[model samples]
Target: MFPIFNIHNVLLLVLFIISALIFDNFRHVNLEVIKSFLLENIQYIFIFVCQFILWYKTGKTEKAISALSDDIYKLHKTFQTETEKKEKAISALSDDIYRTLETEIKKIKTDILTLGETFKTDAKKAEKDISIFKDDVSKMCETSQNETKKIEKEIKNEIKQIRETFQIKIKTIEKYISILNVNINQIRETFQTGTKKFEKDISALKNDISKIRESGQKHSSQAGSNLSLTTNRISTIQNSGYSDTETLRSDFIALVDQRSKRETRGYFTPMLHALTEEISLSFS
Candidate 1:
């Protein structure tokens, strides 16, 4: 058989653990009243103490959750910051592209204007030169069209690249979001568990405090009763002493008066009277 140990602690912790595991935060009404008595106090103190220790662990887990949340938040902010940077770069690139497009258009317009101005100046001579120049113009037009197509292709490719990059970023963000949701769920569970533990501990503490208060009250009442008894005994002694002193005073007064009538009652008699008066005054 197992030897009996610190029964109070054992009972306290055992009851708490059993109750927590069995009830899972369910009510145990009047546990306080039941445990407030000596037997129950001894039983539940261990459970109460254990809960107090777990309270620290619960707080630590909460802190870890908070730290993880901070990390996730920082990751998200970094992603946003990088995205903003990419967008700004794309904006600048787009502006440059638009400016190049405008320049090309201006070049084409100037070329067309030059050909028109020359064509009207000399008809026959111009026709002969125009025939020769038409070949050059056709070649230039072909080259220009090819260059424009190439630029358009390049722009389309760049846009496709940007779209692909954006898609990848979106996927990453979703991944981070998924992780965040999981962490939050875990933290929530921890909080729920921790809350129940706290309740369990609080219930046990209330029981202990109640018992201690009852003990204090009992002790105080006993002490007061004892003090009253002592006071009464003291008063009895004082009364008895007073009565005895009065008897002694009566006898002494009778003896003095008799002595005064019998012979010489001297100045010492007054001294004795004064001494009695002083003694009474000293007591007062």
Candidate 2:
């Protein structure tokens, strides 16, 4: 009973206890009275205490689980962001490389076209020289033939060098492409592995949550059943106490009546018995 009072209300608690005793003339309370009071009040107190404890524990567990889930979610989101950034960077690099290759290819084409135009101009100049030196037939013909052969050799050398340069550029582009493919494959593998790991972690978290919920429910059901059983026992005991008290009052009244009559006592016995019966009935 004293435990039922809060520390801050100790004065009020003391006053209430004193009043109860004062009104009851300090009845030197019996087990039956205590049991009846507990039967009426203890069930509610027990239920409230149990529910509060369960709610507190469940709340804490859910909070912890929620925090853990948030952390995992944040980590997964960060990973995805990082992966996207890396992919964008790789894409930018590939685009830059492609642009550079295209520029190089365009420069090669321009150089080849300029070389062809120079060869054409040189051939036209040789033809004009041949017409002008028509008077020196044998000498002019030999000189023109030598010049034509020299021009053809120079053109062949230039064409060979251009072809070699183009082949080297092609090889370089192929190497870059191969390297890019390898990098892409590696990135994909890493992403897949990370996805699998996160999935496993999420599954495990879900299982733990399910187990916690099941355990909480089981404990709640057990507590409810135990509380029910206790209430029933208290009710049975209270009823039994009431019947016994009634029987005792009746027996005491009969004994008093018999004794009073035997001793030729006064009219007080009937009135006392009636008052006692009324008080007992009120208590019951």
Which one is best on TM-score?
A: 1
Q: What lDDT would candidate 1 get against the real structure?
A: 0.65
Deviation from native of the Cα of residue 23 in model 1, angstroms = 99
The C-alpha stretches of model 2 lying farther than 4 A from their native spots are 1-142, 212-284
Per-candidate RMSD, Å: 67.1, 72.5
Highest lDDT: give the candidate number: 2
Give the C-alpha miss distance for residue 144 in model 2, angstroms.
3.6
lDDT of each model, Cα atoms only?
0.65, 0.67
Candidate 2 on 1-284: residue-level lDDT in tens?
22445442564466568558855853677878877776898887587568657756766687699889999999999999999999999999999999999999999999999999999999999999988777689787899999999999999999999999999977865665565456446544654564465456546656655655567756887656655665565566446545644655565456445443432224435654564565455435
| TM-score per candidate, chains pooled | 0.30, 0.26
Off by over 4 Å in 1: 1-138, 220-284
